[model samples]
Target: MFKQMVIILMTSVLVNNYVLNKFLGICPFLGVSKKLKQAAGMSVAVIFVQVMATAATWPIYTFLLVPNNLKYLETIVFILVIAALVQFVEMALKKFIPSLYKSLGVYLPLITTNCAVLGVCLNNISDGYGFAESLVSALGCGLGFMLAMVLFAGVRGRMESSDVPKAFRGLPITLIAASIVSLSFYGFRGIIDNLFK
Candidate 1:
């Protein structure tokens, strides 16, 4: 069981990253990643939301939805849970850390619709993970998202200083950088299995 949990955690963090590898949440990946501070703030918010969403959704699926023949409503339930969690985070940030709340701006609310958070909850159910495993998976995916955002922010920072051709100046160069970052995550594909071997 321990080994399985470790494998799940590592696989989600590196091999099956929601952002870079799976392409689940690309909007904030590009929008907030312009500055390191914004990226870090958004990443932390996302991590909090993912873990909290999984915590809320897993038991609801297992105890409520599964037994009541309401399995078809998992998508709706999960979204509501995620949106609520995002709102909670937004309020907390606004009250406690107004600077970060303002820095996040519209992207903070965007977490409500972040497919990465939704995907984690849905994938946890589909993968038949136990409660603990689901939480670990969400945490791993959250860290993976943070990693991608920070790295891309660094890349974008460099791009800001570099001299680029007029053709690939803005969105074009950004997409190219994002693609390269996504490809880099493929390097971890077989690593988890090898580590446990």
Candidate 2:
């Protein structure tokens, strides 16, 4: 069971990364990845949102939706849970972590609508993960997202300092870099399969 949990965690973080592999949170992954500090802040916020969403939704779906046979309402239910969690997080950050709150600024609010958060919550139900499994999976996915954001921020920072063609500057260059990073994750395709086999 421990080994399987590790595999699930690794698969979520690497093989099926929400950002690079699944392509779900590209907006913040690009918008907030310009600076390392900002990327780090967003990473923490995203991870918090992911973990909390999973923790909250897993029980709700398992106890409420599944038993009630209201599975069809999952999308709506999950979104409401996520929105509430994000709002709670925003308030906590503003009151407790004011510096991070300022650093996160607008991106913090964006978490309310972040499909990545919703996607993970919904995926946990569809995958039939238990509470513990869902928590670990969400943690892995969030960390994977953070990893991508930090890496891209570093790359973009260097690109800013280095010479580049007029055609490859700005968003064009960032897109190219994103493509390369996405391609890199492809190397993990067979890893999870092999682990299980």
TM-scores, all models, native as reference: 0.91, 0.91
Candidate 2, residue 90: the lDDT equals: 81
* CA deviation > 4 Å runs, candidate 1: 92-107
User: Which portions of model 2 show Cα errors greater than 4 Å?
Assistant: 96-106, 193-197
Alpha-carbon deviation at 100 in model 2, angstroms: 5.1
**Candidate 1, 1-197: lDDT as tens digits:** 99988898888888988888888889889888999988998898888888999999999999999899999999999998888877887888889988977866556677887899999999999998889999999999999999999999999999999999999999899999999988888888889878996
Measured over all alpha carbons after superposition, the RMSD of each candidate to the real structure, in angstroms, is 2.0, 1.9
- Candidate 2 on 1-197: residue-level lDDT in tens? 89878888899888999999898998898888998988988888889889999989888888998899998999999989888878888888899988877877567788887789999998888888888989999999999999889888988888888888998878888999999988888898999788776
